[model samples]
Target: MRTLAVTTMDPRHRVLCRIRIEGAEEAEKICLLMGSEVAPRRQFIAAGATELDEARIDI
Candidate 1:
């Protein structure tokens, strides 16, 4: 198993989600999965969809 640190930043909302994963190559995979799931939700609440696309994540 490998440990990965995932960090996400939503500039529009000024929110951040940092997660640590324990698995084999799960860090990068989980980061994208979580971003895909949350980006849309954030877009719905944001001024526009593009806001979420601008979101940044460091893995």
Candidate 2:
């Protein structure tokens, strides 16, 4: 089950990066691949049909 997630800042919640992943479990790996530190204050959002359209990540 592939999904899309966006890592964001802590207080501002500004989107730092976006990625298309394999599953919910891949969220952490994606963060690391993007160079997140020991405990990066970020966020992850899975993509549904609508979200895919919005984010425009090629499947």
Candidate 3:
């Protein structure tokens, strides 16, 4: 029998380094790069704060 150690981290403190989407092989690289760019932004928006269309993104 083997035992594995597990660590849990709070989502609020999570460092979004990489994002991988299943079945999106070609898009994975693009997604990872985009995530890195987007994660550092201080949106000041909480979860469930706004609907999809209500969200504002500064381009």
Candidate 3 C-alpha lDDT tens digits along 1-59: 32232222555434455545664774553445445566533342333346545445422
Error of 3 at 3 (Å): 52
Q: Which stretches of candidate 2 lie over 4 Å from their true place?
A: 1-22, 36-59
Could you tell me which 10 consecutive residues in candidate 1 have the lowest summed lDDT? Answer: 1-10
Which 10 residues in a row give candidate 2 its minimum summed lDDT? 40-49
Instruction: Note the residue pairs that clash in candidate 1.
Output: none
Error of 1 at 24 (Å): 7.3
**Model 3 misplacement above 4 A:** 1-23, 37-59
Ranking by lDDT: 1, 2, 3
